[model samples]
Target chain A: MKAVVTVTGTDRKGIIAQVSAFLSEKNINILDISQTIMRDRFAMIMVVDASECTEDLASLASSAAEMGKDIGMSVRVQHEDIFQAMHRV
Target chain B: MFNSTEVIETIDMIEKEHLDIRTVTMGISLLPCVRESAEQTAQAVYERVVRSAERLVPTVGQLSREYGIPIVNKRVSVTPVSLVTAAFPEQSPLVARALDRAADALGIDFLGGYSALVHKATADYEQKFLATIPEALAVTQKLCASVNVGSSRSGINMDAVRQMGGIVKQTAESTQGGMGCARLVAFCNAVEDNPFMAGAFHGVGEADRVINVGVSGPGVVQHALSFAPEADLTEAAEIIKRTAFKITRAGQLVAKEAARRLGVPFGVVDLSLAPTPARGDSVAHILEELGLEVVGGHGTTAALAMLNDAVKKGGVMASSRVGGLSGAFIPVSEDIGMIEAAERGAVTIDKLEAMTCVCSVGLDMIALPGDTPASTISAILADEAAIGMVNNKTTAVRVIPAPGKKVGDTVDFGGLLGRAPVMPVHCGSAEKFISRGGILPAPIHSFKN
Candidate 1:
């Protein structure tokens, strides 16, 4: 299974380092990363292989959201299937 | 990898738009639970529900966690109690209490099917059972009840309709804060596989066990329409169809997941855009967004008719089965925009009746003045039943005639049931018509055989 993690906030230091460290601690491999800055606001999205992750998907989602609060960024983790099911036929 | 836009859209729909699965209801058969005595039958009913739904709440939570979609409610609908307790209608409260206790024990949100199908006529024991409904509902917190008093095939039972008029009033007065009335529903052409409540029941035609999912996403549909400001009505309808397709597909996935894990058959994905008290999650707001100045305004019915049809057209293909009342619901108290419209004198009962001829439900969650007579309530039911009978659709009435309150005052049900202004009713009496106790004949079109 795979999941999408979204991070958005003002451009700050160590955003990637903090998020990647949290993911690695849970044994989740980041399959892809895309980051962009628009109008001075930083945004990054990560596709992670969650099949081997130690934490349950729901708790992982809540933990990622909590980590964002700690780092002053807004984060959300959602199952990849929801995106595919809604956007595709 | 899914695009950044897609991830953001899903997250925003949940956090900002209140997108969540309204309910994943389990329909359990109580036919096997009927026993020799009323007490033993009640006991079996409790045990059956408890055993069948022991893992319902936890299983739904696990599935929600795995899928990352918030499932709002876990409910159970059983065989109508009238059938189960036909031998001992006077002692039906025992069954109601047992069901109530089981729901509380399992932590289920609401349990329906404390119901009777008296569309054509009531039997001897059924009448005794109908008389017990007020007390049964007044005493139980989670037990929701409904009665089907008319159908396209059978026509309206004016006798049952008249009795329910008084029963609804008694149910309100006996309960605390008049909330019992909020949980009672009267229906025409009630479907056998609805997952929504105060109206859901496991019809005899259903399997021994099945999972029915009622998917809700008025916010998602409304948001999709917001981006197409430059589109014409035809284009707008297309947008709604596409959005409903997505919503029903999501429901289909969840329904399959839950049924697989629970070892039950997936019944249907009820493609109803049921709204809540939340700001953006309103069917009326969607209608208002479609260029209607107010929900009860002139074009409101046309816009709603298009929306309801577009939803079915888009959703019908997404699910293998779609049997519930699959259309947009305009429950007044449950939609903030609707509440404001009614409070500001922008909407009226007459307009709501006109709209129900096209929408999925009829005058749902509406509040009427306390002084309104019981016969008037029955008249409202007859009029709404007439619409469903002629059109061959499902329509229901769940009006709360607030006690000791008059027009313009609001009664707060709190939570998802929301608050509603006591909309005025016509002072003129329909007593003569309602007093004539007999069946309203089925429409000529219904004679097709």
Candidate 2:
């Protein structure tokens, strides 16, 4: 299963490093990563393979959201299918 | 991987535009649950729903979290209770209570199908069952009742239509502030697999259980049209079609996955631009975005017709199964724009009636004067039913005659039921028209053979 993880907030040091470390702890392999700035806010999108993660995607998504709150950012983890389904067809 | 702009657009629709799945309804057949007596049947009905939908709420919760979208409602529809309680039609309220209990137990939002189909003619048992609707709606918190009074093939049953008027009156008077009427709808050409509430029922022809999803994105469409303000009417419609395609694709994904996870057959994705009372999420606002000063202004019907057609055309390609009343709903109370329009005299019942000729449902969530006669209500239903019967579309009425309330006064039901200002009805009486009780014959066009 693949999921899209998004992080957006004021640009700061180590945003990618923090998110990547968290995904590594959960055994979710990052398949792709991209970062950019929009309207002076740092934004990152990561496509990750969640087949090896022990926790269910729902719980893992919530944990990621909680991690974001602690670091003063907005985070969301959604199945990649939702994006593909809406944007592709 | 999706481009950043596409991903951001999707997220913006969800976060800023209030785009969400309106409902993920499970249709369960209660025919197998009917037992010897009404008591036993009620017990069986309760147990059947509980057993069939035990995992529904949690599964929807997980799906909402995993997909990063809000699934606003989890509902269930079953074989119309009148059919299930046919043997003991007089005691149908027992089944109604049982269904409400089952809804409470399963923690679902609403349970529809406390209904009777008298489109062509009302049988003796069905007639008796229809009498239970008023008390059934009053006593139960989450039970929805619908009476299909007319159909394209069967025409209109004036007898049942007259009875429904009295029933709606009684339901309004019995429930607080006429709120119960919000959960009861009078339908013409009611579909078997509607995922929307106050009109959904699991048809006897359907599989034992199925998952149906209703997707709503009025705000998304409005946002899409915002960027195309300079576009012509053709360009505006193209924008709506493209937006509807995207919205229906998301719905198709949710419907398939929800059905797969719950081990139920996947039913249609009702691509209705159902609105909410929230400011940014009104279907009327979408029409206004298309250049109407207000939703009830001139050219409203044309705008709605184009919108309805474009939505269906786009949604049909995105999902193989698309059914229900899949068009823009113009419920006055549930939509902030419509509510404002009604309050300001920008819309009236007559205008709404004209609009229903092209849109999805008819005269929905409208509040009338407490003194408005039952005959008038029946007449309203008859007029709307005629539109559905002749046009071969679905039409419904969910008007509330708020007790002791008059025009300019609003009745607040709160939450998704929203608030409705008491709109004035015409002074003329329809008693003579409604009292002559018989069947309105099927339309000439219905004879397709």
Candidate 3:
């Protein structure tokens, strides 16, 4: 299963490192990553392959959300189909 | 990799603008459920629905979680109970209860098809079934009923319309604050695959089982328009079209997936901008964004015509399976903006009727004065049905006469039914006109052959 993890908040150091490390721990592989910071707002989109992850997508999403909360950011993990379905055909 | 902006836009629509799958309705045919006795029929009906719809609620929940969009309602629309109970129309309430119990057992809200189609003429059995509607609605919590009284091909069934007025009143009187009337509707040109209640029934022509999805995003359209406040009407309509396209695509995806997982044939996506009582999620608010000071203002119908057309135009492209009432809904009580407009006396039933000509449905969720005559309700239905019959469109009336409540009083149904302010009706009686019962003859335009 492929999912997109989006993180948005005030920019800070180690944001990518922390998120990537969290994914690695869960056996989820990052297929692509994009990040940009405009003024004080920060945004990053990570496309991850979670087919090998032991935890289910719902549980991983909640855990990622919890991690985001602790770091003072808003994070969401959603299936890629929703984005493709909306933006594509 | 996906565009971050597009991702953020979709998220904003869901998290902020209240875009949602209004309903994922499984249409189950109850034709085969009828048995030798009413009790046997009721039992069979319950079992069939429970088995067919067992996975409906949980499947919808999983999809909602996976898609990250809210699926607001999981509903079932069965074959009209009138046909299922035709053997013993007098005991139709038994079937209604069984349907209600099926809804309860399936953990779904509002199972529709407690209906009678007397658009041309009311049969003796149908009349008996019609008499049971008020009692059926009063006895069941999750059951919704609809009656078809007019069509372009058959004109208006004034007799059925007359009966519906009294039926609406009785339903109101039977339930607290006339809330049961909220679950009943009188229709002209009623569709078979509509997923919205209280007018949804699996038409006899439909497949044995199908999935029809109703998609809602008035808030998304309003939000899109907010970005183009200075745009002209044409440009504003473009914005609505683009937003509706995106919303419907998501709905189509959900509909296809929900159908595939549940092992039902994918039906259609009802591209309706149905409103809820929540602030920022209103079709009336979208009208106000188009420069009307309020929804019922002078240019409201023109704006709604463009909106309704643009929604259908865009939605039709998004899904080939677009059906149901594919336009904007203006239910008074269910829209916070419309509710406020009515509270301030700016929106009236007269203006609502005019708006319905261009929109999807008619006279929805309106609260009339407690003493409003049943004949007057019949007249309201007659006028709305006439509009629909002439224009070859679907129109419905779902008004509640709040018992012991007059103008300015409010009836709070809570949840999606919302709060309705009792609006005054015309004092001039239509008793004589309604009492003269006969068919109103098909419109000349209906003879297209």
Give one digit per residue, the lDDT tens place, for model 2 in B1-449: 68888888898899999989999999999999889999999999999999999999999999999999999999999999889888999999999999999999999999999998999899899999999888999999999999999999989999999999999999999998888999999999999999999899999889999999999999999999999888999988889999999999999999999999999999999989999999999999989998999988899899999998898888888897999889989999999999999888998999999999999889899999998899999999999999999999999999999999998899898998788889999999999999999999989999998
lDDT of 3 by residue, B162-256 (tens): 99999999999999889899999999999999999999999999999999999999999999999898999889878888899999999999999
Runs of candidate 3 with Cα error greater than 4 angstroms are A38-40
Task: Write down the RMSD of candidate 1 (Cα, Å).
Answer: 1.4
Model 3, backbone clash pairs (residues 3+ apart or across chains), number: 0
Q: What would the per-residue lDDT of candidate 3 be over residues A8-81, giving only the tens digit for each residue?
A: 89988888988888889999999999887633568898999989997877677788889999888888788888
Report the interface RMSD that candidate 3 achieves against the true structure, in angstroms.
1.2
Higher-ranked by TM-score: 1 or 3: 3
lDDT of 2 at B301: 91
Interface quality of candidate 2 as DockQ: 0.88
The per-model lDDT (C-alpha) reads 0.90, 0.93, 0.93
Question: Best to worst by TM-score, what's the order?
Answer: 2, 3, 1
After superposition on all CA atoms, how large is the RMSD of candidate 3? 1.2
Q: Better model by lDDT, 1 or 3?
A: 3
Error of 3 at B114 (Å): 0.4
DockQ score of each predicted structure, in the order shown: 0.61, 0.88, 0.68
Could you tell me the TM-score of candidate 1? 0.97
Clashes of each: 0, 0, 0
